[model samples]
Target chain A: MAKYLSKLSKSTRSNLYTVTAILAAYIIFTVLIATGNMSNLLQGLLIQIFYYAILAISLNLTVGILGELSLGHAGFMCIGAFTSAFFSKCTVDIITITWIRFTIALIIGAISAAIFGAFIGFVVLRLRGDYLAIVTLAFGEIIKNVINVLYIGIDQSGFKFSVKDSVSLNLGEGGQAIMNGPQGIFGTPNDTNLTICVFLLILFYIIISNLVNSRSGRAIMAIRDNRIAAESIGINITKFKLLAFTISAAMAGVAGTLFSHNITILDSKKFGYNQSIMILVFVVLGGIGNIRGSIIAAAILTLLPEYLRFLENYRMLIYAVVLIIIMIINWNPTCIAWRKKYSIRNLLSAINKKKEA
Target chain B: MSFISYLIKGISLGSVYAIIALGYTMVYGIAKMLNFAHGDVIMVGGYILFTVMTSLGQSPILAVLASIVFCTLLGITIERIAYKPLRKASSLAVLITAIGVSYLLQNLALIIYGTETKFVTSVIPIPTIKLAGGNLAIPGQTLVTIPVCIVIMVSLTVFIRKSKTGRGMIAVSEDKGAAVLMGVNINKTIAITFAIGSALAAVASVLMFSSYPSLTPTSGAMPGIKAFVAAVFGGIGSIPGAMIGGILLGIIEILGRAYISSQLADAIVFLILILVLLIKPAGILGRKMNEKV
Candidate 1:
């Protein structure tokens, strides 16, 4: 451990510290679950933490890295959840293997979300700041409302989609309904588990981290820092913005698939603007532009409600207070310089000096 | 409902939206920040009126006056507490703080009023007006709403155009530093803008919940968003544009609800916003300005 720590750059070493701490915690929790020591409620929280982490990381790309604010992250997640859940429901009898079915579902989810991301991002990304924020928010609300009235079913003939009512999906005796228009697509098979969730999180972390560290990532950040400067240097503004938004959407879609498989039933109401706001809060609290911060924020906030069960009704109120405090702490200039004084780097350097003495 | 009746309903709803959207546009025009908690002021207005009318047994006129005064104060307080510190902060930070204030208000209402819907009796006591040779009917509330909206919009425009205080607001919104150099009381102008905008919100909520009396903590949320959409649909910083946008949004929303899927009303509103923003990024009436390099 000492040898591994000795030769690395300070930033890399600190990042390693964050990664190791999260990993160690996860490992310990997994053991507790395996031994049946953890509560059922906490076990459920594990799946949520993974998916929320995926969402926060994806949002960080557009919000933190790309410097675009989106109030419609849940819109992409909705498309993902409904599409993948619907796909899984229809193919239940035909596809026996859960793993294979989930793989196909994830791919479909990613593609569909990317398609939507491209369509919306292409239009809205042309503008910047408040306009982009509002349009994305509108998109999210539109998707949620549309999903409320959407109906789909499957039968011997093939797949069918309807909007008016469920009865319109006339089918054979063995026909099955996936989404009954506002009733939501129910009867989804529970294929999500700790292993799959952890795998997805790890994959998301690596992809997002690598992207943030890449040349394109630098270009993206450059555009965010100064649009005209980035443009003067001949950076293709639209291309990179589109790339980041599409990738972010695709990742959210993957998270949505995992989310659907984890939950017993899927509903449009679950993916409202409020849900999007909550995810944004996670990104903000996690430390904008910090992937490790996103992971930790998602985990803690997702589990906060369950842990604060005794506080019950006051939990969200308290959560609001915490959110304000965190935002103030993060942005307040005096607090920032103060943070540097107590920051881990300072603490580490102090410890090293003591060791040398 | 006949096309005309639907149109009326749409107009009335549009009027409510216009009043609310005007508040949004004024604040945006002056402060250069989306006052997310602006909608909550409407909710606060409704509850205040509800308490006055129901609890204190005050007359409708008294209740409304009280509501306007209380909300105006509330708006000024909110700006001073939540937004003042965020003046030099990034727009995103201000935006987030605005949202946090929104959540704080909603949850506080949840705690105080509880989760159940609190019904408020209609403020407009007039009977329904029937047209189409006595075949079509309009709610009494609708009749009151349309005129009130028109009055508010015209007066607001005149206020912004003719009044020195209003001109100060425009100057501040244009460039705060320049306004300061020009001897504009930047803080006072911004505070007055908040006060006037919030006063309008109180008026809007009272009228909005008159017909739709199923009030809850979340009642302001949807209207708040739709009004924001209206503000954007017109032009973020333009008053007349907001009025036109609010009315058009009402018509579009009502028509969609009646002719298309009723459940897709919200979606239709948002879709229009997206389409408008894509085609005319500056909005229908918004002035286009070049971003500084």
Candidate 2:
């Protein structure tokens, strides 16, 4: 086993370690829950942590790997949440098998978000940097606001859609409003569980990590490092940018599906600029381009606020302070210098030399 | 007549946006970073005015002046503490720090003031102007805001074009390295830009609260983002651009609310912004910048 592990490349080994770590964590938590060793509060937070970590990973693809600042990630999540919730609600009676129904809903959500992502990418990719960021932000707000005013119902005549209020939906006898405008969708099956979320999380991680290691990933990174240089080398800038963005959007959609399924009701308000910023916070704090760091940061930051519930009014205050402090430590020149000089790799090398001496 | 009234209201709202956009444009011009906390500064300014007028029983003039002074100092302090250390960092790092500062300001406000919305009394004492035999009565806020916006815009333009420090700002924005080579104090110029921006935020706060009559910790957020959109619309880093963008956005917002579904007005405004960005990426007044190899 040791000889086989030694033959694998460093990247593959690291990937193996990540997958094992995640699976181990899932197993340990499942055992804890099964044996009644975990508290209800902690158990409730488990799925949310997985989804937020997924969000961080998705955002990291755009911000960290692709080198684009997306301020409207929540918009794509909104599309996923609403679309998935709408699907689940409409098909609950039709599709009795719980797992099958949820699998379809997840696929629907991801595909819809991917479609929107491609459309937005096509338009916004023409611009660069800050302009692209603002356009995305605008797109996000438009999605949320438009979703807020969208009223959908199903009757004998088929699906009825209205931008007006629910009263205008004018449902027939035995008909029901699936989406009641600003009130949002109610009774979305609480189908999300730790098992599915963990599976999806692993799947997403694999996809992103594999993408990053592939030739396309190198092209994307080249575009990020220097767009002009990448273009000079004959890389299809639009195709790669759209590919990364669409995949990122689709992953965020899956996360949104997880979120919607975890809750009884899904509102567009949950997917807004603030949420986008929060996810961005996760990606930024996690160390840009460091997949593992994003996961760790998302997990810790998501759990921190819940744990700090003891602080009451001061919870957010402390959270903000911690965010600022972490940023400084991570990015400050002096701190970076300090970290470099005493890094674990250097320490390990030094210990080897000392033993040889 | 109602249409005229709505148009006036839109103009007034646009004026408020113009002021806030000025702050954003100026900071972006000199410092080349989005001051996300600029909106929160407006909130702070509103709170200051509320405390001064209601809590401390001060006059409106005094309240406005006090808010401006406090916000200016706040801006300078924020720049010195949070931003100064990040001058040479990546733009994303700076943006995240700005967001952290924004969160810090918001949470701090939450701690100190709680979540209650403070209804502030209008500081501008101008009475409603009854035009055309009371058929179109312009509110006092509009009467004051439009003139105030015009005066501020004109004077600010002059300041940038004529004043020594203002020219220093232009130099810094034009070329940071060249500015330094010419012995321009980059730090001082950036700090002053922040100060001016924050001071404009305070004025915007006064005008905004007077018209809207409500203040919350997050009240500044939407407007701040809108003003940012406005800044980008007019062409980021251009003073005149910020003004036009703000007014245009404000008019569109108000008109969209009045004519279209009020609920989807924000959507319409944003949609228009997206459409405009598609056609002209740099914005109406923004100069076209070419990437150099």
Candidate 3:
């Protein structure tokens, strides 16, 4: 294994390690699940963990790779969730096959989110750093608020949309109010399962990892490091940024599709500022720009609160404290120096030196 | 007549936002970091006031003072513990720490307060002013809030213009390295900015809860965000800009609620922010920042 790793390029080697670790975890969890060793709570959380991991990785493309701070990722996810859920609700009877229906919903979700991403990206080009972060936050809140008041229904004539109350939708005979504004959509199909989630997660991971290693990825990184320098060097900052942002938004939408399908009901309130911040926490804590780190961090942090259910009231409090401590340990200069000095590599090398002596 | 009353009510609400925006502007001007936890400080102030007036049976004035002092101390402590160590770190790290602190404060409040909505008795003793044969009646809270906002803004402007420490803050904001070379105590100046900003937040809490009455752990969040929008609208680093921005935002919000759907009022406010940023990124009063290699 060591010899083979040495033969491969550095990026390929890292990719191998990440993929292998994920597969290993997947195999172990599947075995445990098959043997009925996994608890009910853990089993229920599996799909949620997978979606959150996907969200984190997608967010990493913007925050870590693109070198921007976005506080509205959940907004994109919310868009994806609502649009796809709407599609599924409308086509429930027309689409006989569940898998085909779900596949279309996923596509719809991704495409809708990507469109929003492109629009937001257009506005995003005018701002930088903290300003960009704030605008994105504003946009996210707007999306949520707008969704809250939206009323949608379908009649024999066609689909009806109204920002007013459900009565304003004015349906004909056999017409149903699919989305009842604030009450949200009901009866979304529970098509999400652990196997499908894990499959999608691996697929997204490969897509993102490959994108990161491509030439477009380098241009995005260049813009992130130094916008002026990148522009001066003939990189099309606008094109690359919009591309990355749209892709990231699309992935977030996919995560949203998975989320909405996994549950029986969907509410726009779930895609609030708090949810966005929670995903950001996953991205930040997982080590910014590190894809593998994002996955592991999202998994651990998502599971931490669930497992800490024993802590009761202290669960969130403990979570907050852990968040702070982890940030300090990860980013503090002195801590970084200390970590460098006492890393496992140094320890192993010291042991070998001692043996030689 | 109702329109006139709505205008007054809008001004009053805007005054509260102006106060909160002042805090945001000051901290941003000097520290150059968004103190996301600033909103929670307002909530903390509200809780302190509630405890003092209701539980401790204190006078309203004393309660207000106690809240201000506690919030000031809280702000300073937060800067020292959570933010100071990360001063040399990336903006991303500082931002994350601020967010963590915000969550910590919110969760701590949740643990202590148990998510119950606390109704705060009005501390302002001013009587409601009735006019135009009872067609217009402005609440006592509005009477107190608008004047208080004007007074704070004036004093804040004067202090920044005349005081030595205030000059230090301006110096630091202009260029940190240059300010340090000029013998300004960078840490002390930053701490003072936080103290002053958090103090204004406490005042905003008193005025806000007096009018709104209901207090919750998340009460400060929406107003905090709107005030931030106000700060940005007026041009972030300018004091006068915050006041103007706050009042305009308040009027817009009120008018939007009255004429447009109340549900979409927030959306309108945020939409305005996006438009303002696109058209005038530096804001109404903000100076254009030049990039240097």
Candidate 4:
């Protein structure tokens, strides 16, 4: 373990900086929680922030690394949320044995979501750009509608077997329900302990960071940059894209499982296209393909609405204005020109190629 | 006999979708970007018509004209604000901005109009005419909608084929750099395209509201998506192709719902899209342009 750690440290070289930053963040989180001045509402709000952050990071895996735009990611989250909720409500023991149930739920949810993701990836991953985006969007809508219909079960033998009446699952009246149709499933057991959730989130961050730096990650990046070129060089674009998508979907499922278990509620509306877009916003606003940037952007955007509560009726307007400003700044010609002129890495790479030749 | 009536009804419904699909196709043809907010602009047009009809208590004809003007202005505004800045950016950036604009418009409508569905009275009279063994009844709105759509489509075809600005728009869509070199004002042409497309959306909205008198803030989302599918089905950047695609999609959706399970409506449409994409990625009416890789 020590040797591995040393090797990791040597490879990263900037490990100390990251470690210190993480430690500082942990300290700050603890301090904020310990302070009595922070209301329970604020704490709950922070938990929600962390939940979305996990989702955003997971989605970034596909959107950033694979360079594929999936508008239907929320569908996978819905699958995860529903599957976990169904299992957790299967027996009282599962609910009571919180920690074990949580772990089991995450695993099951992730696997199921990954399977679904792989299935979709096999079919739609062949398409690129706008075609992929539209198909994914359609897939998401289909899932939502199907879930909506299936949630209300058929009448059986005079005894209506609704999601609510399913035996072994007793999450109060609302909790046991699979998905309460339009009203959404309620009584979800809030088993996501804050510390564990944060820890899992950090773990995911590490995994993604590692994946982005690995050989497989480089191959995925190459595919994104030039698919035809990558394929010509013996890189299997289809295989790598599917792998990335599956991993990303699994991460999203994990996030959804945590969310469902934590919030104790599951709504199809919560997993709609809007939520998918919201996650995409976090990825984009944070500077796509940048892990640190994605995390920070997710946290800030998640928390921004809460801080802007005072805006009241004008909150949406203010939000729109802010978005417009960000877009304008990001699109400024001067900024583009500067980036193009001073792209040192590209220049250095050019020089290196010349030297090698 | 009723089958014939259903077919007519399907055609009328398809016509509305075709009108909306034109906007999507034209903008995509010139811009190569899916204006996700285009449907919301239709919603905006509906709301404007609603406001005009209610406040002024004017005739439906006048209200529709007003709505068209409002939609044209809104379209121009959207181009100026949301799309103009990202004209040179990557397609992804423009697509995201389009989504942002869509959300912004939907939420704005929600705030302004409230979440509750608003009722709009039918502007066109419902009339019945006997044809075969059964009576063939066509909504007066269909008569108006069909003729108006036909007129607009024909005029647009003529404009695109003959007029200098229309030719300029086509030229830009074909080759932006060459068109610019030939003294076509790209910005002005783009703005004009948006205006024309949005105005068409407004007309469809008015007709749609007449057919179904309830309006909600998010009503544009599904219609917008369907129109997009129509555009894709015909060919993304083809004008007449959009019309054909829209009508066909409408017929398929309505007939599918009537004949097949209503639950399968959305699935069938998406299935068609996927199948089309797999078979002919350039779309049925769309010509394939070879890319220099």
- The lDDT for every candidate, in the order shown, is 0.88, 0.93, 0.91, 0.80
Tell me the lDDT of candidate 2.
0.93
Kindly list the per-residue Cα lDDT of model 2 for residues A56-144, writing each as its tens digit.
99999999999999999999999999899999999899999999999999999999999999999999998888888899999999999
Candidate 2 Cα errors over 4 Å, as ranges: A342-357
Per-model RMSD to reference: 2.6, 1.5, 1.5, 5.5
Model 1 pairs whose backbones collide: none
True contacts kept of each: 0.58, 0.67, 0.62, 0.24
Model 3: residue B83 alpha-carbon error in angstroms: 0.7
Residue B285 of model 2 has an lDDT of: 95
DockQ of 2: 0.78
TM-score for each prediction? 0.94, 0.98, 0.98, 0.89
What DockQ, on C-alphas, does every prediction get?
Answer: 0.63, 0.78, 0.74, 0.46
Q: Give one digit per residue, the lDDT tens place, for model 1 in A157-227.
A: 98788888888888678987789777798878998888777777777777877787789989999999999
Better of 1 and 4 by DockQ: 1
How well does model 3 score by local distance difference test?
A: 0.91
Using TM-score as the yardstick, the better of models 1 and 2 is: 2
What's the fnat for candidate 2, on a 0 to 1 scale? 0.67
> lDDT per residue, candidate 3, A98-198, as tens digits?
99999999999999999999999988767887778888999999999999999999999998999988999989999999998998999998877877788
Better of 1 and 4 by TM-score: 1
